[model samples]
Target chain A: MSSPAEYAPTARTVPTRSRERAAYDAETVHAILDDGYLCHLGFVADGLPVVLPTLYARVGGTLYLHGSTGSRPLRTASDGGLPVCVTATRVDGLVLARSGMHHSINYRSVVAHGTAHRVHDPEERRLALDALVDAVVPGRSADCRPADAKESAQTAVLRLDLAEVSAKVRTGGVNDEPEDADLPHWAGVVPVTTSVGEPVPDPGLAPGTPLPDYLRRFVGA
Target chain B: MSSPAEYAPTARTVPTRSRERAAYDAETVHAILDDGYLCHLGFVADGLPVVLPTLYARVGGTLYLHGSTGSRPLRTASDGGLPVCVTATRVDGLVLARSGMHHSINYRSVVAHGTAHRVHDPEERRLALDALVDAVVPGRSADCRPADAKESAQTAVLRLDLAEVSAKVRTGGVNDEPEDADLPHWAGVVPVTTSVGEPVPDPGLAPGTPLPDYLRRFVGA
Candidate 1:
C-alpha cells in the first residue's frame, strides 16, 4: 500500500518482494534525483536494450537531458518520442555482515520509466540548458554566458516526465543471521560520501577574474 | 579502427560520433569496470527498456549480476539468455564553462551490450558470489561465512560476456569559446571525490570483534 504522497504502484513499478526498502513518495523520488550527478539512460534499439550514462536535471516533475544535437539518444528523441528508463543511484555505505549472503551496500536509487521527446520549443530548450548548467554547479547559470542562437541550434534537450517512478533505498546497518551471530566476523557499515574539492581554474582565465561565491561555497573554499 | 587487445567494434558497439575520447582497449574497459561498484543493468521488458541499479562483479571477460531469484531481471534471464546493456559511470568533476553550451561533466563510463544468461553451473555460481562479495570489500569473502547450499539456492546470478564493450571518458578542464574567453565568469572544474568514513558496528556484535586488515585499510582507520 502507498501513502497519499506516493505514486500508486503500477504493474511494473511495484517492488517485487522486499517492499519495505522501496518507496514511491514524491519526496523520496525527488530527493534521490536531486542528490544524483549522473543518470544511466536506457532505450531499446534494434530489439536490444542500450544504456548510456548522461547528465540530467530535474525541474519540478520533468527531467531534462542535455547533450549535443548529433548524439544518438538526442537524435532518436527528436524522431518523435523515445521510450526510456532513467535511473540515478547514490551509494551510501558498505554493509558488512557475518555471512557473505547478508552483505550489501546501502544506497538510494530512483528509476523513472517513461517516454522522452526532444524539446522543440525554443523557450523551453533555453531554460532546460540553463537548468542543466545550474545542476552541475548550483547558481552557475547566472554567471555564465547564455547560449547564443547558433549554440542553441547545436544543442538538444530531451524532456521526460516523471510519471512512473519509484525509489529503492537500503539504509541502516548489517542484517546478519541469528545462527551466525556468534561468528568471529565483525559486522557494520562503513559510510561513503561525495565531496567537492577545490576548483581547478582554466589555463586561460582572465587576470583578476574573482571566483564566484557559488563556486567557492560549492567547493568549500 | 580498434587496436589489438581491444574488442572488435560492431555496428552497435562503435561510439556514435567523435570517437576520439572513446576506447575499446581491454585495459581501459577492465579498469573502469573494476573501479565501479554498481552498474545500471538494462533489458527490454514489455517492449520497452527497463534499467535497474544492481551489484555486479567482473571476472576476466564476464560480468556477473548478483541478486535474488525473485527479481524481475534475474527471472527473465533464467527464462533464456536476456539481451542486456550494462553501463557503469563514475563522475570525476563538474566542468563549468563561460557559456552554457560548453558546460559538461568530466566522467569515465563503460557500456557493455550483450545477452545475459543465468549461471546454472553450481561451481561458477559459487565463485561469482564470492567475486561479488570481494568486489564490495576486497578480501571480504574470506572473512565471512560462505553461502551454504540453501543460501546459494535462494540467490541467483546472471552472467553476461563482455563481447561488445566500449568506454567513453571525459577529462581535463572547461572548453570555453575563444570569443567568450574574456568573460567575467570564472570557469573551471570542481573535483568530485568519494571517500569512506568511520565504520559503525552493528548493535548485536560479539564483544571486541577486531576489524579485518583489509577493512582497516579500506576505511583508512
Candidate 2:
C-alpha cells in the first residue's frame, strides 16, 4: 500500500547509487518541480535517445510541456502517447571538498518517468497554455492576449501525469574524509541562487505604461 | 567540404521550429557549454528514455562525464559505446510578451547527439578527472588532494565527442505583435544571472587556513 502523500517507489524511480539522496515525498517533488521553468525532455527517436530543453508548468498532479506542433516529440505524442522522461534541476551550491574525487554539487532535482500525451481537449489545452505562461512569471497569463483559434492550432501542449516522480537533493558543506580534513585545500560551499536583473522594457512599449505589479512582486520574491 | 570553424549540421541537428535560433558555429556551442557544470544526459533504458542530471567537463572536442562504476550509463558504456544525448542550458532571461502564446524564455542551450564511451586509458582518465574538478571552480583541480589509486578505480569517466551539436540561443526583449503593442500588459525582459553567495567554510577547517585565491576568483567571475 502507498500513502497519498508519498509516491510509491518503483524499479525505475529507485536510485542504484546514492540511495540516501532520493526523495519520493510529494512535498519534495513538487517543490523541486515548481522552482524552475526549464526542463530537459527526453524521448526516443528512431531507436536513439534525444533530450531537448523547453518550458514546462505543473498544475496539481499533471505536468504540462510547451512545444511546437512540428517538434518530433510532440508529433510522435499526438499520434499516440510516447514514453518520456522530464528532468529539472535547481543548483543550490558548489561543494568543494579536500579531494578532487569528493567534490559534489548541492542541488535539488526532479525526474519524472511516464508517457507524454498531447492535450486535445479544448478546455484543458486552454488552461494548460495559461499555466505555461504563468510558469515563467506569476499571473502572467492574465496579462497577455489570449491565443486565437489559429494560434491554438499551431501550439502543442503535452501532458504527463506526475505519478512516477522522484526528487534527489544534496545540501550542506564539504564532506572530506577524516584523514584529509587537515589538507591545505580551502574547502566549503559557494551558495548559488537565481538573481533577476532590472527589467528591460520593449523599445515600443506603450509610453506611459508602468511595469506590472506582478513583475515587481517577482523581483522582490 | 565543411568549414573548419563550424560544425556541419546534420538532419537531426536542425530545428523544426524557430529555425532562426539555431547555430552550428563552434564558438557559440563552446560558450554555452562552458558556462555551466551540470548537464542532462539522456540514454535509452529498457526501451524507454531516461534523462539524468550530472556534472560534465569539456576538453577541446570531448566532453567528460563523471559517475560511479555502478551507474547504469557508465556500466553500459564500459561494455560497449551506447547512443546518448547530452544537453546543457543557460537561462539568460525571461521574455514576456503581450500575448501568452508569444512569451518565450531567453536561453542558450546546446544539444549534442552522440555515443558515450568509457575512458580506459590511465593518462586520459587522470586528465579528464582534473577537468571535471576544474569545471566546478576554475583552478580547483590543483587545490584538492589528488585521487588515490583505489578512488580512481572506483570513479567512472564517460566521454562523448561534440560532433553532432547545435546551440540555440534567444536574447533581447519581447516580440509582441505590432497590433498588440498598446495592450496594457507590460512587455519586457527580466534578465537572469547566477548569483553566488558568500563562501561558507567547512566546520572542520584548520584553525589558521585561509580561503583559497581560486575560490575568490570564481566569485568575481
Candidate 3:
C-alpha cells in the first residue's frame, strides 16, 4: 500500500516540548485524525480563547467540522475565514512511573492550525456531510438517505485545509529512572482502548431491522 | 450524597447550538471532567489559535494541568496568568440516522473558560501531582514513589479554577425524521466504551513485584 506524503513542519507546527514525539509525516497525522471521531475546535471568541468539542471528518487534506447553521463559530466563519485550531487525541495507555513526576499518559494526538471557512456550495456541502457520516461508520453514507435541500441548508459544514499539522505520540512502558528501578513500585503501562458495545436499536425501529454488517464489525479508537 | 453546586451561565459558556444539551449543574460538569483523563488546552499564541492535548486532573473546583518547567505555556503562565480554555470530552456512542444530516455522536463534554496560573506553592504542587497520579489509577500515589525535591522543582503545574464551566451532553437514539423512519436504513446507537486491558509489565521490572490491586481493577473512561 502506498503511504501518505510527509508534511513539512513550519515554525508554528513544530512542537516546543518533547520534540522527539512530534511527527510531521502525513501518514502518521492522518492515521491519528482518522481514528478519532471527535475534535476540539479552538477559536478566538470576543478576544477570549474558546474550545468546543465537535464531530469531524477528514477528506483528502481537509477537515470538515459539523455544526448548526446558527452556531456562533460557523456564522463567524461564514462572515470571514475563522482562524482555528483542531485537535484530536486518543489515550492508548496510562504510564505509571515509579515517581509522580514521571507519570504520564500514552497518547496519540494531532494538532492542525488553519483557517476554517463555511462550505456553502450545495454539492460540496452534501459530499462533506456524507463524508462525516461515513467517517463514523464506513459505508454508512450509502446505507442512509441523502440530505434533502432544506436539511442541507440548515446544516453548516466548516472546512479547514490541513496545511499546518503535526501529530504527537507517546508509547511503550513507563520511563522511570534507573535509580528508582528497585523501588518496589509497579511500573508499567495499563493499555486503554475504545471498544464498540452492542448496538441499541431505536424504540421505533421497524421490527426485524437487523444490525448492519458495517456496525457489527465496527471498531473505534 | 451531596450534589455539586451549579455555576451560573455567562454569555460565553452558553452554547448557541443545542441549547437543550447545555448543562449548568456542577455535578454534570465535574462528572464529565473527572471521567476524562485528557483535555485539550486552548490559548492564543502570536495572534493564532493553538490547541494542545495534555494530561490533567480535577480536584474540587480546580483543574491541574501537568507540564514541564521548560514548557512554553507554563513559562508564559508563570510570567502572568494565561487565558485558557480547557475542554474534556467522552464519546459514549455513535448515533446513526436514516439521513446523513441527522447523524450525530452521543457524548459528554465540558468546557471551562478561565485563566491558568503557574502553581508556585511546593506543598500544593506535590498534592496536585499526587492527585494527578491518583486520577489515572485510584490509590496510585501511595503505591508509587513520591517525587524528590529536584523532580518536583522541574515539574510545572498549572491550576485553572472550575469557573464559567458548562457541560454539554447528547444521548439516546438517533433523532431521525418521521418521514424517514421507514427508509429501510439502519438507525441506532452503537455504544462506545473505553476498556482497560491487561496490564503490561515493564521489561526491567523487579522480579516478583506483583501487579498492584489498583491497576488490576482499573476502569478507564
Candidate achieving the largest TM-score: 2
Score residue A141 of candidate 3 by CA lDDT: 91
* C-alpha DockQ for predicted model 1: 0.84
Candidate 3, lDDT over the whole model: 0.86
DockQ of each: 0.84, 0.88, 0.82
Worst 10 residues of 2 chain A by lDDT: A1-10
TM-score of 1: 0.96
Put down candidate 3 lDDT per residue, A37-128, tens digits, no spaces: 68999999878888988889998888999989888889999988999999999999988888777888899999989899999988888889
RMSD of 1: 2.7
TM-score for every candidate vs. truth? 0.96, 0.97, 0.95
Docking class of 3: high
- Look at candidate 2 and tell me the lDDT of residue B189: 89
lDDT of each: 0.87, 0.90, 0.86
Model 2 is docked with a DockQ of: 0.88
What count of clashes does model 3 give? 0
Say which candidate scores most in DockQ.
2
After superposing candidate 2 on the true structure, give the runs of residues whose Cα lies further than 4 Å from its correct spot.
Answer: A1-3, B1-4
Minimal lDDT window, size 10, model 1 chain B: B1-10
How far residue B200's Cα lies from its native spot in candidate 3, in Å, is 0.6
